[model samples]
Target: MTSAFIHLKASRLGRMAAACLAALALAVPAHAEKLPRLVLAGPAAAVSVPLIHMVETGALKEVADSVEFVTWKDPDQLRVLALGGKADFLAMPSNVAANLYNRGQPLKLLNISTWGVLWMVSRDKNLKTLADFRGKEIAMPFRADMPDIVFGLLAERLGMDPKKDFALRYVASPLDAMQLLITRRVDHALLAEPAVSMALRKTKSFPISVVAPDLYRSVDLQQEWGRLFKREARLPQAGITVLGKAMSNDALQAKVMAAYEKSLAWCQKNARQCGEMVAKRIDLLSPEAVADSLAASPLRHVSAAAAREELTFFFQQMLAKNPALVGGKLPDAGFYGNAGRP
Candidate 1:
């Protein structure tokens, strides 16, 4: 009877050990499953390089399970990717987001990545201001881009129609715009940082002047927008966005917002380091250019209040300009998310 009792006790112990191992195996997978997967669309300009760094340097990995940085050659390509449900998050102009959202596409703005970084570079010594742009051919990227929109607004404020007052030459890229300016094919070109800096560096014969670096500030577009609408109109530039259909869980939405806040904080703290990391990733820019771009670029943290206010303003502008852009149905309070809510 004692021997029988001993054998039973041994069997019980073995069973307990097996149970513990099984529990551990189950727990491991549960932990892994909780991690989030994100696909980010990068901007065409070099400023987007830091976002690539945030992923490569493991800054974003701390918050997300994995991040895939996809480079878009142009705005239209980025829009196509967003529409196909291939991309989870995209950094694009607010207007583009409005266009998508209006078309029944479920996209919400999460944060603003950039503001106004456009520069009107001119080879002429006499072209000192926007007033000098009259009757001059300006090389622009395209008719629908952020630069085009901003320049159009600037022209309107100056009492000139962009299509009629100035000869707008369409260029494929900033480099192409620079080439046009250098060869004297265009009187002026809309250029952004690094490219603007690069163009000036390459052309030693013709000195290029920044007709406007703080163009938004100079023209009072924000104020004008507010005055016209009696509501705040912040320039909707670049930001993080996600598809409404894919975001089903409230818990997941909370996690994404938390991640954005954390990422923005990380970027602000390590600006210089992030710049270096981006330079290495793109392999096109020099370390010095990267550092300067990072310093000059308006990379800032967007508060929840600011994000809400800015998005609302952008949506209102779109509604006024073209309600069809938002499907003729205005965005409800839910559109702003918790960040924008009072």
Candidate 2:
């Protein structure tokens, strides 16, 4: 065909292509960029009770298009989810978060979910302080984890070597340690709530038939931490963190934070109901027992910025004890969120 004829046919085809593109554009939905699914995970602990309540209340419906909430009874499972990039939002021990962040992970702490749940519970009435365990048998669990690390810090602060000053019988798990306590194998145990509450309940059967309030003298180490620091006395325990990918979306972050706080508020307001829900999730204790423990649980939702001083102090203590605890050093300014919203 002649050049002029070929050019005329090409122009007609171009016009037809433009017409088809316009028609397709008009047919497609306006919000075609489907948002990615978000996953929030934590252990089945009281600190995570609020998140569970949030999931139960459909709090994330306002923010997330699709969210999956998964609870693990083991911290290691939660750790894998948090560190392996399997979860978008996760709750983990503050020290683990700090350590991960300091080691150059893109994890950022959103807020403090748990203040301090660790308690020093003992069958001996005289076992009051760290001084009391100078040469007594004590049970410890989850080696190098928060409980073990915290106890080490407490011992060092009390001017005693944990190994030499106290006979700490390390157990495989907190439940194992609690078993030792119930059997009266160890006079003292460093346990977290749920575990503390569980041990207290077991006392009703063995070791003592009569369960008095003073059967096990307990001390809240969060208060002790506050006293030791002489600053923020509350124990800033585990909290929620988001990988860089999830936090890249500012709107999503705000929604997640707000939903979290709202869920936590609802649980705080309806303690008994929340505890029943939590007990169902944990299954280690009854609803009434869980409710009572949840009410007494030292769970809090402090924004990272408001909690910086407390966090820095806590991390510093961990670092002083062992540089590896906080990943050799403290995290940078970016580690703390602008605030886990209002």
Candidate 3:
């Protein structure tokens, strides 16, 4: 009778286990179906290369059920998407993210994609330092943009006034500056990646003959920033960001970050193919130029939580430069999307 009772108890336990399993099986599909559909916005720049690779390789499939992508024509479109809540995630400039966060936008950076791609391209052979540009003209693009911000800080540190020490000839875009350089209208140009590559490709002295090669030996601003800020370990350029509304789900966020990280690795491994995609998808730059700019773009993927210290430094520096640049003050702990914080 005891053995029979034991058998009956075992049967009851098995039935309960089966019932629980059936409930879980029924819930998983419903939960998955309910997962938010993620819309990702990417700007047409080298910064979006990794996420582009993610989209191409179906890496996002590992995290999201359905992901729609919208390629932005310019930075303003990105701002519109953020303000309008049109996208759940976006890849944009790091400083822009900081500025937005400080302005009370519910934005949280995910990871940095590009370390630094800005370069000072000029024909000036004796262009040794910021002081050398005194009384000279530079083809500076995006008047108060990232490149200009860095230039201003470095010039001031060197005891020079950026506006007065160097004549900043502002242009509508980097391509315009490149055209100016080619036409011998400007001797120096501060160009971001892909633009630098494009300028090198379009120069008369490239791939066939060397005509005007002032853009030949461009100074990498990433290295320059490091040299100037000796205490900082990272350059922390631009990165991917997610809406604060999306960060509430830790599992989804982790999966997304993992997918993005994998995508970054894949991008580095298959730059040539990814460059072709970047060129064809958005017409941002030529395929050849994109391929060459991949390495120098300094693509990195550091989660916002892990990057807080360096980001704080960068934002604080910008705050020091112009209170408006970082929206008056450094962002609080809530600004980041780290597991501990969010």
Off by over 4 Å in 1: 1-30, 34-37, 62-66, 125-128, 182-184, 201-234, 244-246, 249-273, 303-305, 322-330, 338-342
Candidate 2 versus truth, CA RMSD in Å, comes to 5.4
Clash list (residue pairs), candidate 3: 205-209, 205-210, 205-211
Poorest stretch of ten by lDDT in candidate 3:
205-214
**Best model per lDDT:** 2
Report how far residue 124 has shifted in candidate 1, in Å. 3.2
lDDT of each: 0.61, 0.76, 0.75
Q: Which of the two candidates, 1 or 3, achieves a greater lDDT against the reference? A: 3
TM-score pick, better of 1 and 2: 2
Candidate 1 colliding pairs: 102-325, 102-326, 102-327
Summarize candidate 1's per-residue lDDT along 136-173 as a digit string, tens digits: 88888755566677677656656778889888898766
Total residue pair clashes for candidate 3: 3
Q: For every model shown, what is its TM-score relative to the native structure?
A: 0.73, 0.83, 0.83
Error of 3 at 335 (Å): 1.3
User: What's the TM for model 3?
Assistant: 0.83
* lDDT tens digits by residue: candidate 2, 1-342: 699899999999999999999888976643443354767887656667777777777777645567677775555776677668888888888888888888878888889978888888887766667777788888987788888888888778778898898888888666677778876677788887767877777677544545333347476787777676686667788888888488786666777778888878887788778877777666666666566667778776788878888889889888788889889998889999864652
lDDT of 3 at 29: 83
